[model samples]
Target chain A: MSKKVKIVAATGCPTGIAHTFMAEEALKRAAEKLGVEIKVETHGQVGVQNQLTKEEIRAADGVIVAADKDVDAGRFKGKPTVDVSVSAGIKEAEHLIQQIIDGKARPYKGNSNAESKQEESSEGKSAGGFGRAIYKHLMNGVSHMLPFVVGGGVLIALSFLFGIHSANPDHESYNEFAAFLNSTGGVAFGLMVPILAAFIGQSIAQRPGMVAGFVGGMMANTGGAGFLGGIVAGFIAGYIILLLMKLLKGLPRTLDGLKAIFLYPLFGIFLTGAAMYFVVEPMTTINEAMMSFLSNFQDANPILLGLIVGSMSALDMGGPVNKAAYLTGTALLSDGNFFFMAGVSAACITPPLITAFATVFFRKFFNEQERNAGLVNFILGSTHITEGAIPFAAKNPIVVIPILMVGSSISAILTYIFSVQVPAPHGGFLVLPVVTNGVLWVVAILIGSLVGGFIYGMYQKYSYQKTK
Target chain B: MELLNKNLIKMHTNFQTQEEVFEGIASLAVEQGLASDKKTVVAGLANREKESTTGFFDGFAIPHTKNSAIQKAGIVIMVNESGLEWNSMDGQPAKFFISLLIPENEAGTTHLTLLAAVSRMLVHEDIRAKLLTLENEEKIYEEIKRFLSENM
Candidate 1:
């Protein structure tokens, strides 16, 4: 009889929540069902548990990296590695495992091997598998962005609760409160873009790549690139760092050690910033025209605008795409235009409100735990929290999507009718104190959300009745 | 015990309180032989509520009971126009409610089927919008049926 082959695996996602564990379980189950013995490692938010040691890696026939975020591929320098997203790990784990067993997998040696002999390169690692790694790092940055979103939003809600809706850019009391809020909340918000860039960079170039990415992100934001620019800057930083790391591969031990940490970051940041500022800026500016076009769209197409904004709000929940729409609308805040932001803020809370209220009104439809979760979702929605919908949307997209669209559209219409305008490019209740018609904006949102929730509940009720 | 039946979706509902919502679904359960009495059904479902909330992810909630309050199995679907306020993990309001009353032993893969169907359809934005726009009981049923058939 032929000897059995053994392999080690790791599974993780950017969120490090359900998908991470789910993939791990799937892979384990698949291996067991296939009559194979496998060792799996998981790096999650609670930290790495059930980790595979060097011995396990060395003994395994091959490694499977099923992750959405960056997993260190350096360790398995010469081992046959099959890299896939966490979703694939969960859905196609057996197939992936089998592929690895058949020796169809490729080896991935960090950037160190990129400059090695061409003859040995085919046996070396590939660099093109960094897309998934970059996505993972981006999610890390977003995970860290939540605190800022909540804190800033709540503070602004408090400002509104205090009835301090200031419109002037030069008021003392308003500025002081704004300063306090900025100090408390803005710092975290400010970190969003840089952190995004840093992690994206880190994914490609490892720990040493963070500084360059962060600096590049800062430059992008300062140069009007915002988060999107930060993303571009991050890739540039990462690739530059990786190239430099490759170039410095054959240096002496001491110099090489210092070069990876200090020299690479220094040069990488300067090069990335210079490149983005000079090369990327002009190219991206062309896209900014799209933003400008959206901003100045006054063709009396309220329905079109509503649909666009509604879709954009739900498309990414709170990612960069969502932020783009939000920022475009809020950018008018400085010019005393709050209508755009009011629409966005309204669109923001409607999904959660509808979900929460539907559970409360129709207890028969929800299981005990889901109804309870609805309450928390509603609270988050009221505060303009959007990520709260992620778990639900992730679990059931069809039901959530329609619910989101209906709720968002209703809110968007209400905001338009209320003429609520926001000046800032990105904020929820955090921008309330600085928004036009803050109280009216909130009222409009509440009313629209009520309508949306009611409609959704009715629809669910009808659908259930017919299903029986 | 199926708490949700085809008639869960009523053309016009007059629910003014939690009891009304419970009664609406409980009657269906009683008729389907899932529950012997409305009060007992309410109590049993309410008891389950003490254990945990029923807000499932993906914009639908399946409030159910396998406990003693139910004598028969039935399902009741409810859709609100302004939507009810429930705490969801996503911090959003729920628009659809799939109330299910299943017999302790009889509620096997059916529940999973329903959950999976809802999850699958919810993932599609266009189909979901069509569901929300659906007004007639037959149309809603067709949508659910299609979703289940395709997904299952």
Candidate 2:
């Protein structure tokens, strides 16, 4: 048939220590043994070596991605690919090459339209771990969804600068320009969840997934299901389309075009729509209930709520625990609970300030290096960079973390007690102008930091004495 | 290439276990000024091992690490007198140890060429046998260096 088959292989391992290069060598040797031309791309710790060009991939008969990590399989969309672990490339290199020669390579159904359906029925042709594949698809969707969120969020935030209700024509503060910007931002923001779902679908089943995902996302949005609903809709839509793709694999080649454009979309959307319809309503209710429940707790007792928020925010100092607190506050903020976010920000701002204060008060107890570092913390604490406190907390977490949390809690409690409302999700004191009772909020944070700093300095002095 | 030399190769080395081998490598690399400290190099190798075994079947293991602690790129070969547990593909202990240490900042071409060449040589059974059975440190050094120079 062909003069000499050309194969392109990518090899990678978790550490890029030894197996990656070994696999590359094995693949090259095997290709030579089989009398075929081959090019090996190695994803090593040193980074990608002997990278395969687009022209090479297009010209090659098959692709072998022997990777324990993501090598951007999206590039080899329509090419026949044998995706396997790196170990296989080393141990069964010749077999993999031979499979491609024997026309056993199944084309990757990337963004490429339906082509090379002859071996579509082949079992496990594009072998990969299931959870990783889905995770990759989800990340693809989220990345595409980000620009819309940022652009829309900034515009919306800017629109509110005129007045809170300036976008409403009937409101006293209504401005036509404000309305225009707000609506435009709303348009972009509205597309965020839908785009997230659509791209996720597209990632899984190609174009057909896009169609089903968009339709499902629209249903989720209309049903008031919000972010969680969009996620559910996207996954369901993608998988249903995938199942449909498998079912329709045995159809005649003549019907390939018909199946992609007509059959797949029609069934994919209908099924996704039916499934998402039942899911969206429940998700919306759950979302509302969750928000209201948290808000109710906010109303019941400010002290307990403040302590929880403060402790959680200061616990990890920008690690996952801190992020969880921030994200939860952001979620509430999205639902118009500015009070909760105000307390969250106050707590976040307090920890760094505590460290800054500790260095100042306990100067003799601390070394020269720590005192200089403490001065830098003043700038860090002012802008609400909680990570600035990490070095201090990391020094003796057992003694420092609890003290910082106490200070952070006191600040959050004061902000809550004063009924401070911070409109922006983040930006620390930078968003103060828009904040109701902004000065009071700053007072709450300083009081917390002052108390925290006092305790920290005392502890440092005590530890110094004990060590001596 | 200064990647491998006679001085880098050691024949009939005495190492009972992986830790002992690492201890040997750490001291050698520090003495040669290829690394900042023994702990960093030893930790780097241990960390790499924790992620995945560097062992290839048929009595070969190539442990490698690229980090800021490394002062330069270099290779060290130790033909162990006794086999050590490596969890190799063929379920056999690895005796021939080829460790590659790379600086964090290098463009990667130097080590990549060396690694590729070493792996290419190891891939062929006959060549592997020849490498394993090489008489002394000088012969092993010359053979490995020749392979690297020719391929690189």
Candidate 3:
């Protein structure tokens, strides 16, 4: 017989919670039962422990990596690995080990031919599929945008706090702290559009699209376009640069370098910005008008508005629908409409609350680790981080969707009934006083959110048990 | 090592239920003269699986054993037209079964090489789909060979 081979593996879920260690344990038990000598390397939040050395990887027959997040696969590039989601490792550890022993797993091959073949089979990017790709690109822009927003917003708030508006020119105070804060904030704000554009362009057409994309994003921002416009401008900049490159493909080889740095970027930025200004702006204005018209329910029925906003807010959990409801609430902040603010506040925490309730009431639908994560999600939800429910939602959308919707709706209705109000954009218990009828508002949200969460949790539990 | 090349594929639609998976696969093995008795080989594979589940996380089963009951070392790939339960890792039932028969003294590391190839391709949804199109034994052999030659 061929020499008996052995393999070791490390398995983990994101959050470095119990599942990470549980998967590790499962792999170890499976390997031992299979009569193979295996070593596992676990890298977790507590830090990398029991790491596999170079000698171990070189000597090993194969590797099994069941992870949820992006783990650096570079270490075991040439090694045979079975990439699986972390739950698989926990639930089917032995099978995974056996499969490895039988040779059913390996690392991804990165050759050009395979990549092109993969791309072709994937249908060259479907329409709705672009959401995730766009989201990734937008995340880079958002990450960069945050620093500017925080600095600029804080400075603007301070301008309200300390800056003087004098009837007489002599009475105004030029505060150094405010000036410095405002100036730095302005610089940060100036870079926001450019940085957003550059990254999006990079995502679309690589480095060549950066200049054009930046210019387009800036134009969109300056032309009264918002975050949505930045996204459009980014795409415009990237594709426009690509078109330019295609048109100039026949250029002499000697001018390639110059074309890359100067000609491509300069012309790309100018053309894309000019096109977006003349073409995209009018379209964007129309789109905004539609959105605003839809958002205009000033004297309309409160209950109907609450239901629409709440349901849409929970539909996709931070998607366009969710953003629509949120923006509507923020707009009301300007009008001192506390009812809208209350509705938004209630909607914001419902997702996480429902998720947490699922874990508590319907323990069967979720694994042990998910239940643990749910607890953390509860605290996060109250703090207005509705995104905490994303993982669970992605995993079990059918159940999560209805649960969140019901929960958000209940919260929204309660907010409207109580005539609750919040002055600030977001925050929970800490910022409660800025809200109208602070005590009653908090009570309504707590009771409504709890009811929603409890119902979802119970339903999830029943469904989970039935499946098992 | 005897089944080192992509020649030991056994595809049939009659293996509808989990109970008949071993029977259908063993029947093909006997017809090819890879093994004389279908029952013996099936029993051996079942016994090995009883010791531990053959399921993998990515929805795969590599049911195999070191039993010397077979005449030649061979790998028999059986694709179920409809997905069935093989007690998979993700708690989803497995749809594909790669039954490998390594000789008592297998030649070189051919078994390891072939296993690695199959496992690597399982991750590719395209390759998996192409494998599912094999309606008969000949098609199975042809598709697997083409995939290996192009992919491996």
Quote each prediction's TM-score: 0.45, 0.46, 0.40
Q: Which stretches of candidate 1 lie over 4 Å from their true place?
A: A1-135, A165-179, A243-255, A278-410, A417-468, B1-152
Cα lDDT listed for each candidate: 0.63, 0.78, 0.63
Name the best candidate (by DockQ): 2
Superposed on all Cα atoms, model 3 deviates from the true structure by an RMSD in Å of 18.3
Docking class of 2: incorrect
Better of 1 and 2 by TM-score: 2
For all candidates, state DockQ relative to the true structure.
0.02, 0.18, 0.03
Model 3 chain B worst lDDT run, 10 consecutive residues: B115-124
Q: Candidate 2, clashing residue pairs?
A: none
lDDT of 1: 0.63
Sort the predicted structures by DockQ, highest score first. 2, 3, 1
lDDT of 3 by residue, A282-378 (tens): 7445545535754776445767766766676676554455666677777778887767867777777777777777687766566545676678766
Using TM-score as the yardstick, the better of models 2 and 3 is 2
Tens-digit lDDT track of model 2 for B59-149: 8988878768888788888889989978677767999988988887877565666665676677767767888888898888888777766
Give me the displacement of residue A340 in model 2, in angstroms.
Answer: 45
Measured over all alpha carbons after superposition, the RMSD of each candidate to the real structure, in angstroms, is 15.2, 13.7, 18.3
Lowest lDDT 10-mer window, candidate 1 chain A? A113-122
